[model samples]
Target: MTDYDIIIVGAGPAGLCAAIETGKEAKVLVLDRKQEIGCPKRCAEGLSLRWFKKMNLKPKKEWAVQEIKGAELYTPNGKSIKMKAKKAEGYVLERKIFEKELAIEAVKKGAKILMKNQVIGAEKKDNEIELIVEENKEKKKITCKIVIACDGVDSLTAKMLGLNTKLDLKETDSGYQYEMTGITGYDENLLHLFFGTDIAPRGYIWIFPKRKGTANVGIGIGAYEKETAKYYLDKWIKTQDGLKNGSIIEVNAGVIPVGGFLEKMQADNLLVAGDAGHMVDPIHGGGIGIAMEGGRLAGKHAIKAIKENKFSEKDLSEYTKEWYKLSGNDLKRRLKGRHLLEKLTNDDFNYLVDSINVEEALRIGNGTLTKKDKTILFTKKLITRPKLLKLMIEYARD
Candidate 1:
C-alpha cells in the first residue's frame, strides 16, 4: 500500500509528460504495465519542431531519426504534387528513445515509476480513487487524490468509471502500418501521401521516412462494415508502386478516434487525456502532438485543482477549455473536412485532381492565386461537379 498525491496510468508520451510536469510539485507515481519503457512502439513517430518550441521542450539528439523538409501528395492516378516546406518542418523520432527520455526526466524530478504494474481497475469513494494493480502475481492498491488516465485510445480505466468513451462511426479510423528496412530511393526529408479510392476509400496512405534507408509506410481507412484495415493495407502494399518492392520489417494495427470531443473528460476524482479523450487530429489521423498538448493541459489543471484542495468537475473544466483553445477549433474544422472527403466519388476525385493541377500550374505561372484565378478555378470546379462543390461549401461553413 502506497499513498501518493497523484497517480498516472500508462507511460506513453502523454502519461510520461504528465508525470514530468506534476512530479515537479507533488509526489507523483507513474505506472506502466510493460516491463520496459518504450517497448512495442505503435506511433508513426512524426512531429514538428514548432510544437516542441511552443511547449518549451528541446529535442534530444538521440531521439530524432531524421528532419523532414516537406510532404509529397499523390493523386489516385499516380500524379504527384510536392509541397515544399517554408521552414524547418518536422522530425521522424525514434520513439523508443523518446519515450525513455521522458520517463528518465520524470524520475529525475522525483517521480516514482513502477514498471510491470498492470492496472486492473479503479475504485472511487470519499473523493479519492484507489487503483488496483497486479505485479508478480501480487495485488497492490494505490490511493491517490487525483488519477490521470493517460492511457491510449479505448482506455479501460475510463470505461470502468462509466465515462462517455464512445466514438462516432464517421469520426473513427482504423490504422495499419509497416516499418521497412530494405527500402531504397526514398527522400529522407520528404514524406509521401497517396489519395484515391483504391489506395484508401475515406483516408490515405503515408510514407514517412524514419532514417536514411528505413521508412514507416502505413495507411488509415475509415472504420466501415465488412472493411478491415488489414485487408486494404495488404492490397495496397502489393499494388502501390512505391511499396511494391519494399520488405516489411514490422506491422502494427491500431485505431484512431477523430470524432468530435468527448462529452465529459473529467469525473469526481479522475481525468482523461490524450487518445483516451479522442484528441487526435481528424484530417491527418495524427495523435502524438495532440496527445502531448492534452497531457500538458491536464498536468497544469490537475496541479491547480490539487493545490486548491478542490478536485471537482468544475475545477477540471479549465483543462478542457485550454485543450479546445489549442486544438478544438482545428479538430472541428477537420472533422467537417473529413466528411467532405468521404462524400467524394471516384469521378469527383478525378475531377478534383485535374482541377488542382490546373490551379497549381496557374499559380506557378503567376505568383499566387489572384481574384481572377479564384473565379476561374471556382467556376470550373463548380460547373463540372456540383456535388463536390456542395461538400466544399459544407466544410467552408464549418
Candidate 2:
C-alpha cells in the first residue's frame, strides 16, 4: 500500500551505505528486522587504515576503540613473524556503534529507515518490485522501483526475487568468536594470527584487541570440518595461559562465504550486495569494508537507473561490470592464492614462516605484496626448495 523509489533490505553496513548513496537522489526506505541499528554484531570488527581512507571515513574515538600497529603471524611450529608498518596500522571497533554511525549518515542523506520491519515476501514485475514487510503484528506491502538485498549469508529476499545466492559448503567457512574481557599476554597493538591445519584447518585464529583487557578471540575453519569452530577455539584457549581466565561477554557464530563470487548481481529490478553476494575476502574472510564498498556502488547505480528511467537487467548490470574492474578481479586472484595456501602441509607452513624475514612480513601486512607467475613465491625460498616449488606449480593449474 506504499511506494518508494528504492527499498533496501537489512540495515547492515552494506544496506546503510547503499541508502546513503541513493537517498540523496531518490526516495529510499531501508528496512531491518532488528530493533536497533547495530546489536549483537557478527564480525570481529577489525578494519584497516587503507579502507578508512578508501571510504573517506573519519575514525571517531568512541567507536574506534583500539588502534592496531601491525600483526604477528604464528606457524605450526610456533615460529612467529612480526610485521609492523605505517600501512599495516588499523583499528578494532565497537561495531555496534560504527554501524550506527553509518546509519546516521544514511538518515542525514534523507533515507527513511524502519527497524524491526522484516521483508517476509517479495514479488517482481517487469519494472517494480513489491515487498511484504512484517512489522509488530501486521503485514504491509510496499512497492518500489528497485530493491537492494543486503541481508547477510542467509538472505531470503534475493531468492524470493529469483537470484540464487546459495553457497556450497566448500565455499563457506564456519566462524566462531567470543568477546572476552580480562584477556592478557598479547600485544594490544598487533593482530595475532595462528595458522596450521591442526589448529584451524584451512582458516586461522585471530585475536583482535578492542581494549587493554578485552579482545575478540575467534577462529575460522573449513565449514565441512567434522570438528566445529568452537571446539577448536575452546581447545586452543585452554592452552593459552592468559586467555584461559578471560570472561566471555558475548559469543558469535556464523557461516562466511569466502569464495564463490557471483558474476551477476542484478535482475530486472533487484540487486544483491554484501555477504548475500558472497563478497568476502577469501584469505582473511573480512567483509565489512568490501560490503560497504559494494553497497556504495549498488546505490550509485540505482541512482543511474532511477534518473534514466531504465530498470532492465542489462541497464543495471553496469554495477556488476564496474565491481569486477574495481575489486572482483583482485578478489579472484586472492581466492586462487587461498586455494594454493590450503594445499600447504603443516611442514610447508613452518618452512614458509621460517623463510620469511621481518621486512617481507611487513610488506605483506601493509598490503604491498602480490605474486607474479610464481604465485606462492613470497621469499626466494620457493626457488631453493624444489619439492615445495613443484607442489605449488602443480596446484597453480587453473
Candidate 3:
C-alpha cells in the first residue's frame, strides 16, 4: 500500500484545485477515472469575469477562447432582451486545455496526478482512509490521511465513505450538450439563452460560443421532466435556422445538483467538495467556479486537519461552516427563486419578458437581488401581473 497525506478524486477543477493548495504543504495525490483529462467536457463552459477575478485567474488565449460581452435572453414568444454591461463580461473556455493547465499547475505545486485511475471503494482504517483504486485493471490500495471527494453529481466516493450525497430528482437537473460547429446568425461575443416551459421545462437552453463558427449548445431541465433534455434541445434546434444544420462533433449527458446541499459535507477522515457536495448555483446549474471555491476551501481546512492530526468529523466541520457563510446562505435564497421560476407558465414567462428591463433580468437570472431590487421588482415590474406578483413576493422574501 502507498501512503499520501491527501487523496483527491476527480481531476476536474475541484480536485485539481484542492491538490494545488494542499500540495503546497502536504503530500497530495489526485486520481481520476478518465483516460484523458478534460476530453469529455460536461459544461457549457461560460464562466464570468467576476469569478475570474475572484479566483485570481488570468485569462489565457489558448483556453479562454471567446470573450463574452453580454447575454441575449429570449422568451417563448421570441421577444429578446439584450443585456450588455461591464459586469456581465466573461469568457467561453476551451475546457480540455483549461483543465490540463490546471493539472499542470497542481503538479508544479508538487501534487502527483494519476490518470486512468478509478477509486472503486473506500474504507476507514485505524487513522487513515484506504482507497481501493483500479489502475489498468489492476487493483491497489492507497492510504491517505484525508479524502476529498470531488467526483461530481452521483458521487460514489462520498457514499463509499458513508456520507449521504444522494440527490432528489427535483433537486437534480438533466443536462445534455453538443459541441457544434459551422453555425451562424448569432453573435460570437455574447451568450444566448432561450426560456419556456415547452422549450426547457424549468430550465433554459444556452449557446456559449467558443469561436466564430463553433459553440456549445446545451439544455438543462428537471431530471424528472416528462421529456428528456436532449429531446427538448433537438426540438429547439430544428426550429432555429442557425443551428438546424450545424454539425455536432461531440455529445455528452450529465446531471447537475441544482439544490439539496448537504448540511454536513464531511465525515471522519473524509471531506466532500464540488458537485459531490452540491456546491453549484441553484438557479443556473453553474458549478465550475463554485466547485473550485469549494475545493480550495477544503484544501485549506484539510491542511489544518493534518497539522492538528485531527481528522474527526467535528474537526473538519469548519470547512462546511465557512462554505455556508461564503455561498450556502445565498444559494438557499436562490433556491427559492428557482422554485418560483419552476411555477411560471409559458404566458408568465412572456409576461415577465415584457415587464423587466435588462438589468432586472440579469439580477433575477443570477439571483442577486437586494431589498431595493426586490422592492422595485414587486412595486413596478410585477404590479399589473397579480399572479406573477404573488409568485415574486413568495420567492423574493429573504
Candidate order (lDDT): 3, 2, 1
**Model 1's lDDT to the true fold?**
0.78
Write the residue-wise lDDT of candidate 3 on 1-398 in tens digits.
33999999999889988998888899999999989888787799988887898789999999999999998888899888877766438899999999999999999999999999999999998889999999989999999999999988857998999899999787999999999999999998889989998889889999999999899999999988898889999999999999999999899889999998899999999999999999999988888899898999999999999999999999999989999999888898788778988999999889887777777766775677778988888888789889989988877666
| lDDT of candidate 2 over 110-134, digit per residue (tens) | 9999999999999986578999999
Clashes of 1: 0
Selected candidate, larger lDDT, 1 vs 2:
2
Q: Who wins the TM-score comparison?
A: 3
Model 3 regions more than 4 Å off: 86-88, 365-381
Lowest summed-lDDT stretch of 10 residues in model 2?
361-370
In model 3, residue pairs whose N, Cα or C atoms come closer than 3 Å (at least 3 residues apart or on different chains), thus clashing, are: none
Model 1 vs. true fold: TM: 0.91
Candidate 3 vs. true structure, TM-score: 0.96
What's the lDDT for residue 27 in model 1?
84
State which candidate has the highest lDDT.
3
Report residue 299 deviation for candidate 2 (angstroms): 0.2
CA lDDT for candidate 3: 0.90
